[model samples]
Target: MLIAETSEGKRVNLSQLSREEITGLKKKKHYCPGCKSEIIVKNGTVIMPHFAHKKNSQCFFFSENESEEHLVGKKLIAANCEKYGIDYELEAFLPELQQRPDVLINRKIAVEFQCSPLSIARFKERTINYQAFGYQVLWILGTKLQWKDSCSSMQRQFVYLSKNIGFYVWELDISKKEIRNNYFLVSSIWKKFYQTQLFSLEKESVIDILQFPLKNHEEVSYEIASKVACEKRIHCWNQQLNQKSKSSLQLQEFFYQEGLNLRELPVEIMLPSFQSVLLKEQELIWRFQIYQRIQRDKKMSYQSLYRMLKQNFDKNYPLISDCQLIKYHLSLYLCFLLQNKLIIEKEGYYYPTNKKFTLKKTSQEFLGIPLKYGMINK
Candidate 1:
């Protein structure tokens, strides 16, 4: 931890002191703010000067041995806070919540710089606890936790929703000394897509950057899938069904139970949307479910459809405290359906169109038909 309480109960920050000053202060007794246990100062030429708990100390706050990257990231944020003249506390422990954020800004915003893997249960617990106490918690992920081609279920929990940016994640690059605002994140069956805006820690204020989207509204444009791409994916699904892949078998079983052929389903089932990320099942599976429902019932209200598909939606995004994401995605899906003429909306109810829903026999046949809906604009 960066801050430690002195013998006289005064808080001292080792980072603010020079090497000589830190060496002199090491002579006096200091204790941890969380457990009030004696903590020794470790001033090495390589690592940052900080306090460490004694071996076998049972303090939750100082239990884990912090990595060099974690230490550097914390120091960078601390320096940024100072540069912006923001009132903050380093490693401040909240006795009420029994939690210590990496940096507490104005005692309201709890900034956590997570460099290591955290279980979903623990992440949710800390997030809910902070929110319960009326403190907005922001989790800035480290390089280790950043997603590559696709977003993992654990990484999705870090996504925060905002009016300016649909959904976003904050990433700190210790190597570059910059923070990346990866916003408008959308997921596909095989990949995750998003736009990134980098903010140099030397140039931007961390507090101001957090609120940048709110102040400046920017349009996010993304293509869900091209007709050719969708056709290719459908072909891949057909191959999976032929091979009886586990997931494919499950989806096929559902289609069989409904007296429908999975491969013969309408091409519209392959359509993707930004909100489809909320679905726990594959987009095609749930989309087909909705398609089948409308086909059987002739008409359905949005409320009834949402209720039916509630089980299909993922409800585990703990960091997204602002919006009802499931409903938001469903609304978008309905809008997309309406746009594609697959469904007609009238008086808050959706009815299947007279237009026939059929799949082409070959990829060439599918590509011959012009797709009216290719991308979703946000």
Candidate 2:
């Protein structure tokens, strides 16, 4: 909340002020630009000088408290935008939408630097409302975002979309004083994996604060991610091989009855489903269902698959992004099956190749066989 208005109604940006100017402002008594509440000039030596509401001032955007990290992050970003001539205002109100963004960029794009957690419902409502206002909303995350190696499922709901990138994290690197745009072409949160041929963010201006870990970073990072995906997949399979559980017994009972051990399953059977952010069901289960349904009906249709999975997939699960994941997963995996010749596509329908898959009427394949086969797809 660095920007405020003077008694004379002139806009004041506190971050741009010197210590002497700040002292003068303290005597002048500025007020919040948005709420018109009296504000105080805080010029502490430990942190950047910014304005705060005089004790107990209630603002509309206060359903959640702003942390110290949140304050610093917004100030830095607003200051950086100023330095770059990005044309921004801190906490500018959008009249039509009756909403305020942390930083209004170019009087069009609304940038929010979220440092804390919010429910999925509130997040979606804000995003949808912003979109309804015809203002592009960019969520620049502070501290809460994690890289692939250390990602947790709880943070999945923070995912957002940008034009070029399918799903991206606008990350705040507080220590480095820079931002990172981690764009993913395809990823699986369940696997803690992202598959993008490259990840590159460069400084396009003097105040441009984005950084890619290495030059031509996509090539190096992609190689590493690919290796990690393979290793993790094999590691999971081996772990399952060594473990004792009802799941193991159930898997063995079903697939073994079909004379197919895990290794004998097709490589393409368990290929990772792309960008399944909200999908709680394992890819193996749905893919197996597709194989079985196709065998019974002699065809797989997108509508049919969606209808079937909708019955069992958890609608109660929290969704983080705008995409309908269950629909996308079904479509993408079916496309994979068709591409690998495991299933033949005729017009809009898909038919399984059970005989060529080494199927026999002699034994019934476990319904979980597909899940078991595809569990390690990474």
Candidate 3:
């Protein structure tokens, strides 16, 4: 259907209507989106339009550049695909594909580009539908929509995934261009696919995987360090070497090293400083580490990885609340890491880099600000 094309450069669509129906509606009310008022008809055409308020009429919402907000994301995704040299296309707001997706990339993949709401049900439903078609789906949640008045305005969260319905959620703060969190909704089911070794990664995958945990500020608590080592399946030699006193500064120093590729020690051996061995948790971690390697190697099965993740979470973190809720915090932490460039996703894997990571670098550049002096100082 032909959506509204306004003189003010606004394009609104009633995707449900046909071209004929759109013409019919145009006859009844020459709606001025700016004023939410009906326009008067002169000889055979609409007259000079001015925004007018109708009694008891709710004010028309003049949302800022829906096209820009929606399409910028698609453009970024497109660029990312292009940088990786992948194929894609934008659907715009064409009625034929309204229910389809905002952008159709690779024909086998669909994208719903939205910048509002944390819709749990909607996301779950869409993931299922797109996945059924074996299409990889991505939801670019607009974390940029915050109120100007509220200084406490929170950034929106973004979620991206492939279709298999495996409750695994990895949060990426694209504002910072980092992988924020890596979590499983149904860890048990995730564990199952994981155990089956269902993920393939390219050389770049190693970078994304290893760099993920380093994105966050260096918090080398046993748990954090363990998760980092477990996620990357690579040991931090500096952390291991500085075992006498595990300080955040020490961990930071370890990351500052020039060119160090740490190896994965078997689950049995505890590197010098690690006090507690992740025994029971080792299986889940082992699967995850292997999963990372698979993503890095590009020779793993996604189905197998999903099964392992699902089975592990179900058998272990069975509480729906804990599995879903508490896990988000951990994931968010990972996202912070990615935002800072400490972690990157080059191919299929997430890894750390020798380069320092900072979200301020990218977002500020996008906003045309070298750096907000006061904010940076603060």
Candidate 4:
């Protein structure tokens, strides 16, 4: 029905009213601000029917006044919705009715652009309105147009209400950007540095690189390794004894530090199940020597690896082990490196597989592999 302004007041014009508007009013017939019955428009006249329920009737009212921030936030959300090609509508605001969210998207989306904190009561009211309307709301935390501020804090979280637990809201960190960046980094690194196109395995690394590029692949790997080493800085080698002699004490210490010896070091470092594990002290001296020799000869055999580790450790620390034990340890050490995928194995021999190591295949694809530390299962 059409609403007309007359000397008496606003009146309804049934003849001029379209079928759609009538249906709309009918759908809203049960809605009343006070404990009143359905108000129906009929035959160029408006009639207010009586109702029994007084204070218990459900009703909603609307006006058109909103806070300045609310207006600005709604405009921003509208802009974003337009950019993302989303459908939305701005509901009318009423006086002192604890404003509904800034914008409602696609009838099912609620966006609360929260720049300033609100009381628990106000926040709950706005959230409840969206929830009641069956809208999935996004409470945008942080200030407006502050990209760097948003990126700076690593602990921003999202909260939403649930139907099962009345008024109960759950919170979780934002993961979309982080996950996206990681994937991109892995993909780029795989195509560029490693020359491989296997984007699947390079998931986290790819994402990390995309989010924060630290340089080429070799530089990145060395960076992680160096950081891991420097944090602990555990001196595994003794420098005093071999200082005056031609002893290969530095090489022995490197092996010991890296656990590249006859006996394989146990991976777990449990201390009452509470303390963190100590960092793996790699045999830098021995590893460097092996690395150099492989680069120089263009290949490394079991004989060379054994001679290097055994001679250095035995000569410098003679009472460390016997000949038989030393041989077994060297074999086991090489096997460990191969198992961890730190070194490449080809034709009964091992070689470093990092960016620094030269490979037979010149056209090999290098991809960024994500490195994760601590527990694997959990």
Candidate 5:
């Protein structure tokens, strides 16, 4: 929405011009860069001056309604690039793909500012198009990102396009011009997200982000990440307990009927995985499902039981995750069960040790355990 097509077919960025110039340019006719429909300049005092299509224009960007925040965000990045003397362009148009990036640098890197919720499919399509044109795409999400504050089940989802390619959520405090870079390194093994606090670019002369070494950055151990995830999940449940989310209320009632308390879930059930984050069912539900199944079956035929669970999960939690997280968690859960002597395996089958046993530790107590998975340099 920031870029408009002039009568000469050249892209005009109103943000670069002075208020007097923009106010004067509003008198002339303009057109939407994306739709090529007649456009008008919105020279508002509060929002940055940008072009908007005429009434009822069928432009996709019109429906999106470019936010003031989006306007200011891209300007900030452009300013930073200029300050550092990096060669850049604003909304560089690609004639072949008919795509315009928010900021293009050195005719190679195209930066897309995602201020609005974009479809995963569209996001991929844009990236693919950029790659096909030999341009490296860097996705920077606008600061609209929000995760549920309470439920552990409502864990934050960090979309990593690959080990090297991932989404960047830029927390730009416009007033202070501070950018908090919260980078995530996903565990391909567990499919769990691990966040790394990268160095600030507040004073950098050259942007090394071009190197994109996210895969090499290790910030937290699997143990601590799981603990934090568990805390968030519990917080969500506690919130639901107060607000009465039907599902949480029902889960609590089920636990109560089973002679159990929601808060005091056994330590063995706090399973964590990166890929399994898509699952809407709380970790408690799935973990308890396994526990009850093992208790009832006396001994579990690991292969058959795993296959059955996998089939159900394929339906409940799609194969959307990049890694085999569900499978890893199942195997890891079995390891935990064996380690605690909660279950014993004989001839490739697992059997419960005792009919009934008092809990030695709770999920809360297990938080103290040091994370031990992968090459945990952190």
Candidate 6:
């Protein structure tokens, strides 16, 4: 709420004014641009100078308790837009959508500086609403919402996919006065990892940095779990099964009904693929399902396999706009099988080789054969 409209309909930006100027302006009346409700100016030494709605005023656009971090971050983005001479409207309210973004760039890009917790339903609704009106919404996380070792379900909803950067999220740091592009993000069973690219608000143009991935044609490479690491992860899953954990017990029961042993899953079950993030089920579970289908059918078409995997995919990821990721991951897994001579494809049908599934004494023996673990080419 940095910008407020005067009685004469002229917009006033408190961020651009000095303390004395703001103090003088407190004498006049101002209103919120969104709800057109009367707002009071707060010139406090603790927090940044901004407009606040009167007590008991129920404004749909302005929150009663907007955090200090959110206000600062919003003003920082507005300053960056000003620095670049980019045409932007601060806290612009769209009547049709009844949503007020922190900053609207060129009347198309809605920059939302989310410093507080938001429900997934509301987040999805806002995102879908913006997209419906041809507005591209960019969600930038504040310090409070940034991910550490691994992302929570809510944090995962902020991740966006791209060819050059793979999966990415944006973060704003007020202290650093910089925006971070955490890209090529991948997750293991235990943790998540990614590389970061920082853009200084003082030196970089926000528009150019945001468009870099869209314009760049080169692909990015990320390391997957090593062979030993993959084996250890499977060994951990076996340990959970031995402990009779509820989830593990459920999976084991399902496998037992299908005449399969959870402890002796094949090496192919744990291979890493970028699209693994799309599913909440373990890679071993879904991969074994694929193997079982191939075994029973003897041969299957790509469409059929895709439909089968779709049943298990975790479709809760709302930010990942691409609907064909399941197809992409399935194709990658099939290619790996083809490369290893474990499966042969001819006339659009995949035929499994006569590779026998055997019992293994140790986890090390599960991945005895050397295999690739990361991204696969189609």
Q: How high is the CA lDDT of each candidate model?
A: 0.74, 0.59, 0.36, 0.35, 0.59, 0.75
Against the true structure, candidate 5 reaches a TM-score of 0.59
| Candidate 3 lDDT score relative to the true structure | 0.36
In candidate 6, clashing pairs total 0
By summed lDDT, the worst window of 10 consecutive residues in model 2 runs over 364-373
For candidate 4, write residues 127-215 as lDDT tens digits: 55655555555565434322221221111122211111111111111222121111111111012111111222113322222223233
Residue 65 local lDDT, model 3? 28
Model 1: runs farther than 4 Å from truth? 215-218, 235-249, 261-264, 273-282, 311-314, 321-323, 358-378
- What's the CA error at residue 149 for candidate 2, in Å? 3.6
What's the CA RMSD of model 1 in angstroms? Answer: 4.6
Q: Which stretches of candidate 4 lie above 4 Å from their native place?
A: 1-70, 79-86, 91-99, 118-134, 142-155, 159-378
lDDT value, residue 68 of candidate 3: 35
Which scores better on lDDT, 5 or 6?
6
Compose the digit string of candidate 2's lDDT tens values, residues 256-338.
Answer: 77666653444344454233443432566677677778888987687888888877765433223313556556755765566
Better of 1 and 4 by lDDT: 1
The regions of model 2 sitting more than 4 angstroms off are: 62-68, 148-154, 161-166, 185-191, 195-202, 205-277, 282-289, 301-328, 356-378
Question: What tens-digit string does per-residue lDDT give for candidate 1 at 1-378?
Answer: 788998889999876889999999878999999999999999987778888998888897754588878888988998999999999998899999999999999889999999988898989999999999999998999988985666667877888766556667899998899999887666654566677989999998988788765755545455534455555666877999788798878877887887877776566666553334444445566677777798789989987877877765555777763235655555556656776578898887889986754433322210000112233322
lDDT by residue for model 6 (115-228), tens: 878888889899989989989999999987886775566777887876555667899999898999887666665666567889898898789879855655434444443455
Query: What TM-score would each prediction reach against the true structure?
Result: 0.85, 0.68, 0.29, 0.26, 0.59, 0.85
The deviation in Å at residue 60 for candidate 5 is 1.7
**What is the RMSD, in Å, between candidate 4 and the native fold over all Cα?**
21.3
Candidate 5 at 20: error in angstroms? 5.3
- What is the Å distance of residue 188 in model 1 from its true position? 3.6
Q: Which ten residues in a row have the lowest lDDT in candidate 4?
A: 270-279
State each candidate's clash count. Answer: 0, 4, 61, 21, 11, 0
